[model samples]
Target: MSQAAYIRDMMSDPASDLATGPSEVSSFYSNLNVLLTGGNGFLGRLLIERILRSCSGVNTLFLLLRAKKGKSSEDRFEELFDDVIFDRLKREKPGFAQKVRLIEGDVGQIGLGLAPEQRELLRATNVVIHGAATVRFDETLRTATNINVRGTKEMLRLAKEMPNLKAFVHISTAYSNCVREFIDEKFYPPPIDSDKLLNLVEILDDAPLQHLTPVLLGKYPNTYAFSKAVAEDVIRRNDHRLPVCVVRPSIVIATSKEPVAGWINNVYGATGIVVGAAVGLLRTLHCDPDMIADLIPADYVINNVIVAAWDLAEARNSNINNADSSKNPEIDEPPIYNVVSSCQKPITWGKFMQQIEDFGLQIPSMLCIWYYCFKLNKYEWVHKMYAIFLHLLPALIVDSVARIVGREPMLWKAYKKIHKFSAVISYFATQQWRFNNNGVLRLSAKLSPADQNQFELNMDKFSWSEYNYHFIRGLRVYIVKDPLHTGPKAVVRYARLRLAHYTLISVLCGIIFWLLWTLVRFMGI
Candidate 1:
């Protein structure tokens, strides 16, 4: 039976063992002083919004943010709240903004770049959610290691120092163990020792390190996954018996349901794919159509992260009360939850693409350069042929036209960058992995019906078909900055583009046929 059906049956039966009392989750955060890194990031921002809105009794949320592009941490925090995602938060909890406090720090720096007083202040933190990391697949090995590997070690070190640390939730990617076909709720042996690899990056110069990256990465596909795998090992080695758990989410996209439906703040990972295809920029993708998409919504991930912190802390408390140190105490490793969709609610790439095309074209973007059309190739050679004809040829012609008109000739350059990016992500797209999400189910089952409703992470309950409709609409509003009010005009414009696209194709075919006929007649064979 599906997890949703099982949960529904369990809830309906009064004799069932599952708890139906007031939520322990929100109560766990009562008077809880939490320190959260990556509070300025996409998921981090959602975390802050959800915690403040859902767990009303929680004390303060200390956001660890570093100043970037000359903006002070305080300035950045103010601007962060200006996003439309926070609009509903402002209405529901008028005073939610007051709960957040910013601490200037960089995860890449020594001791988190904190002053002595700032470090002392964090000693009183009850919960720590380490969500910060560079999500870029093509990031430099040095940078990826610093932020993902070394940064994790530093966070663990800091968490250990906290006198009141109850739970430390580390946000990781489900693809961290992508080299393996089947992944369980446990740590795989990392490609290299965390400390040893850190030392290597520290000693080596950039160019040589870049050259050595492929060799160092070994079976891992990219720096992001490699560093995250190593970072998990860092936790395994240095957690120091803290209440820590890892939450690995796969291809996080827009919010399924929450403060707002289909709300997305960034165009990373799958969001980029949807947006690129919707805008008619991305024409060809090299991927297995049958491979599972493995997309978990952002709200689901946020809910799981919050629940993981509570669940881990509760487990720690229970373990303390039980106190069985004699029974292989060293075997008590941190729990890992693979927050993915495929286990409970699976959708294939072909279905994913068809749904996007069906729903997305209905509300096409005004920013679209061509009619919304894309092709997926399973074979690399076939994909290359498609790329040359469908992608590069058009791009070359457009760029040549622009150069003649003295308009900077950018289409070819843009396609080059787009192709490189597509190549980088094709690794994940072409492959499928079996992620064991039994831990996630157990965690949800442990939640009271009240908590489960408020902070829902059950993937079986999420409808990807409906979500894709809103996904495109959200892309228009948030990413494209085209609101629903303008969608009608955009739709009309799209119809014209669609007509022109087919017309051009027909004319080109006719010209080719005529040329062939003339050559045959001239040859007189």
Candidate 2:
């Protein structure tokens, strides 16, 4: 009933004062110090921005970054300002950047590669958000295991050291357990023991390890999901000392709201498919029309991450005061939240395709290659045939023309990459997964009313139609980085392409008809 009783018996954390109001939540974050991993990533950036913007009381954001591309972490931190996503923060609070401090460390390393002093400083952190991982589907087993699995292990090690740590939000994917059709808000056994895998990887050479990958993965799709699953198992087995929570978000796409609508950085996950089809590069995809497109806005996922941390913190604080461990033994197991849309705001692949087609016409890509046309089918064989006629053949013809003109033949390469992308993504597109999100809903209910509004993870409140429109527009601007002014030109180009396509079809049909007439005459029937 009331928030106080709900917290004590329900979550077993006696310190939850959130039953009182949003002020308590705010007061909790005020003057708090956070240790954040993967601060340079798309989701990481959103998390940092939300924390600074939502909780003004948050004092310091200590980012864990290693030297990348010959640049120090501090140098890369300066480059964050150049990103359009942070423009709002810069304009609103000129000194907002002051709150973020950099810690030089590599998660792939033992002990997180942090200096003794740096580790000591992190010991005072209030919360640790570990979101760093190698997300590539085709990544080598060694690289994937090192970054995704070993990296998480290091985060747990660091998290255990934080004396004031209230919660450790370990970001994972809903697809980690995709081997099954139904995934509940709980940890399933990993494919292999984390430590054993680590030791095995270290003992075997690169060639042997790569060869054994297929055997190691077994029913798993790729090393990314395989390693992430193992990483979760690692956290599950060793999460006793810290207040750990696993957040599994399914198919995260562009931002629906906040800072900017339709904001995205990379052409990964569903964004690649959406952008490729909208630009007329992708023609056909093998997907069951009825399969749920469990896509969530990046900002929505970020909201859940922030609120989850606060929820766990308030609960932990409440526990320290009253020490009611007997109330809920279920608390002995780590809390798992599945942040997915299928259970709340389900969008079928058929609906998503129509949305893309509709918005695609309105927001044509600035440099459409064909005419922004595509199709989706449930049959895998048909998809393969379409890939040949609609994809490979066309790519060959285009590349041949480029070769004749002495220009670089690139279309074939692009199509090859597209084929690989489709092959990998089709696993989810062609299948159905029923993820239960009752835990996520329960987590949201625990947030303060004010926090609930500011940190918006309510899927019931999400508008699929409206968000999909902005999502397409976001691909136009952010993913492709195209200027809005060029949309009109793209529209005209699309019109011309359509005319040429029709004319070519007419000529080919006439040629076929003439050949049939000649064949009949020769038969003399």
**CA lDDT, every prediction?**
0.84, 0.82
Using all chains and alpha carbons, the TM-scores for the candidates as numbered come to: 0.93, 0.92
Per-candidate clash tally: 0, 6
Cα misplacement distance, residue 163 of candidate 2 (Å): 1.3
Q: State model 2's lDDT.
A: 0.82
Clashing pairs in 1: none
Residues 272-292, candidate 1: write the lDDT tens digits.
888888888898888899999
Give each prediction's root-mean-square deviation over alpha carbons. 5.5, 7.3
Candidate 2 lDDT over residue span 1-525, tens digit each: 222232122221212323435654556678989888998999999888777866758989999998889998889887876877776666555787778888999888888889999999888898889999989999999989888999999888887777778889999999999999999999999999999999988999998998899999999999999999999998898754688888999999988776577788998888898889877789899888898999988888897787778788766767667667657544567778899998888999999989878877986765777766588879999998888767877678778889999999998899989999988999989888898888789877876676666666778988889888777776776677666667678788788988876775576567669989999999995
Q: Which segments of candidate 2 are over 4 A away from where they belong?
A: 1-24, 506-525
